[model samples]
Target: MPLRSVIKTQNNQRRSFGRDRSGATAVEFAMVAAPLFMLIFAIVETFVISAAGILLDTAVDDVAREVFTGQIQQADIKEAVFREKICGKVDFLLTCDKLKLDLRTIPAFADIPTDVPMKLKRVDDSSFCFDPGAANAITVLRAYYEWPWTASFLHKLAADTDGNSVMFSIAAFMNEPFGDRLNSNANCS
Candidate 1:
């Protein structure tokens, strides 16, 4: 072929390739698929975690009212009863065995400890406490739960060594002076 003819053929092929739209949609989707999926998963993870936290907070508040009014303290087994009450409220989305509770008397509102760590991978008796305190005493109740993530990439959000994120809820209030909390009938209803 002559050189001029060869050059014209190459130009025509280039124009045809540029005008082809058959694979454009596939290419565009491929380019955006990864980041798009990641964003969607992140949003879902955030929503689920937020919802779980809210549930935990509400459960803690509701159950803590029992202690504030001296109902829990009147129970024969204060710790066990308190745990069961809290678990009943939050068991829909969270495992009951994985729940941890800490209830103790605080000298004053300012004395409430804020530095409690969540690094414990396994929830156990040593991981928390239960001290409902006497009537008219100030107390703080805290609950901790380790929530597992469906997406492995979300492990980085975990505070526990087991690669699960921690959810926390707290309630602090004074006992209502219900009178003779310990000697009263077990009215932990």
Candidate 2:
């Protein structure tokens, strides 16, 4: 072909290509798919984590009420039983094995510890203990769980070495004077 005709043909093809809108929507959607999916996953994961935390807090509050009312006495329920009860109540998104419980009596309400543990794995850790105090005594109950991140890209959200974040709930109250004050040596598992 002649040079002028070849150049004109090339320009026509370029214009045709530029004007074609056939797959434009698909291309635009493809470009945004990854980021859109990531945002959705982040929102969903945050919601589920928040819900699990709320469930855990509700369970702790309910169980602590039992202790406050002398329904969960050292003489009646074992530590394992108490733990099972809490786990049962939080069965929606949390596993029982990952749950940790610490129930103990404080010298006074003002003596309640204000620190959260830097490392937590099991209920047997030094930071965890089981001791239901006597009637009218001040007590604090705490629960913890390690929430694993499902998305690899969200690893930065994890706070623990195992690539998971910690969820915790606490309840503090003075036990209602119901049971014998002497029956306070409760063991927690």
Candidate 3:
């Protein structure tokens, strides 16, 4: 073979090898970036939702404690109080207006059917009010939160049209705030 032809053949092979690797990195990056970005976003969203739920649960527990202790008057157990005291703490993630608070008294802990109903009870007093022979009374406080899912994919896969509504409840039995003089109608005086 001629020296010039041999040199040309070598150069052509080198050019073809370089061209083959040039676009490979870009294709690999395109393949990997999309799913990686999606996974990161999903992780962040999960943390946000979990933090919101924890904050709400803590707020409900605190409010229910105040109610049972007679620190908050029965009349104050309205929507306004929930908005100001509970929802106010987690306004960044949840809307106070969308939350529902229900308070009830249960005859026994066993009688409380679900977290939705049990957490709504403001005053349990079952331990203090019940006869020694009778089943202990319990207070249940139910807090229903209508959480709105921000991610479109999460909404489509995990949430309903009304958004992801989660109901959280906290219950405890303690002495009645007013002892024997406790009147169901009267505010804590």
Candidate 4:
């Protein structure tokens, strides 16, 4: 073929290929992929928050067992010690420094205070309250963690005045007989 004819044929083929609709699906997918991926990631993040909640509850229960059985008291546990133990077991994604705790030992379940003090309420990054009470005492343990909120609705449900979502766990039980039982007042501060 002549050089001029070859060039004309090549240009025509290039124009046809450019007009071809075969790649339209790919273009459409590229356009839609972003929102789809975002939705998927949002779902995964939601599941993660839920799993973290369950894991937080589990960790609290595990630590509260020691407190209920007087093991924590026998070892002379402090607030920092309790926080360290729980934060170590809970989600590493969470900021451990913002973790807050409130523990009070009531004399009897009937004597348990009506007020549920520790909640995902106001933003208080103060110290943890450590009061396991005397032996055989009814211990009320409340743990609060200010979880980072990605979804706005989560903040609406569990978030404090701040934007962070709050996670709470409560456990109450009497101490075991492994330690010496002593009489202590309820409503520990």
Model 3 segments more than 4 A misplaced: 1-21, 74-79, 115-137, 159-167, 175-177, 180-189
Candidates 2 and 4: which is better by lDDT?
2
Residues 58-140 of candidate 1 have per-residue lDDT tens digits of 99999889889987777645466678898999889889988888888878999986754643564443645677778998888
Better of 2 and 3 by lDDT: 2
Query: Whose TM-score is greatest here?
Result: 2
lDDT of each: 0.79, 0.81, 0.58, 0.72
Better of 1 and 3 by lDDT: 1
Per-residue lDDT tens digits for candidate 2, residues 74-143, read: 4576678889889999987899988978898888788887656764532234667777777888999988
Candidate number that wins on lDDT, 3 or 4: 4
- Better TM-score candidate (3, 4): 4
lDDT, candidate 4, at 87? 87
Superior candidate under TM-score, 2 versus 3? 2
Ranking by TM-score: 2, 1, 4, 3
Q: Which ten residues in a row have the lowest lDDT in candidate 4?
A: 180-189
TM-score of model 4 vs. true structure: 0.69
Cα-based TM-score, every candidate: 0.77, 0.79, 0.64, 0.69
Error at 1, model 4, angstroms: 36
Model 1's number of clashes is: 0
What is candidate 4's lDDT per residue for 21-101, written digit by digit as tens?
899878999999987876787688788878878888898899989887777777775567777888899747556777677
lDDT per residue as tens, model 3, 75-176: 434435444877777678777666665555556677754633222322222222211111222556666665566666776674333445464555555534
Off by over 4 Å in 4: 1-27, 110-128, 151-161, 181-188
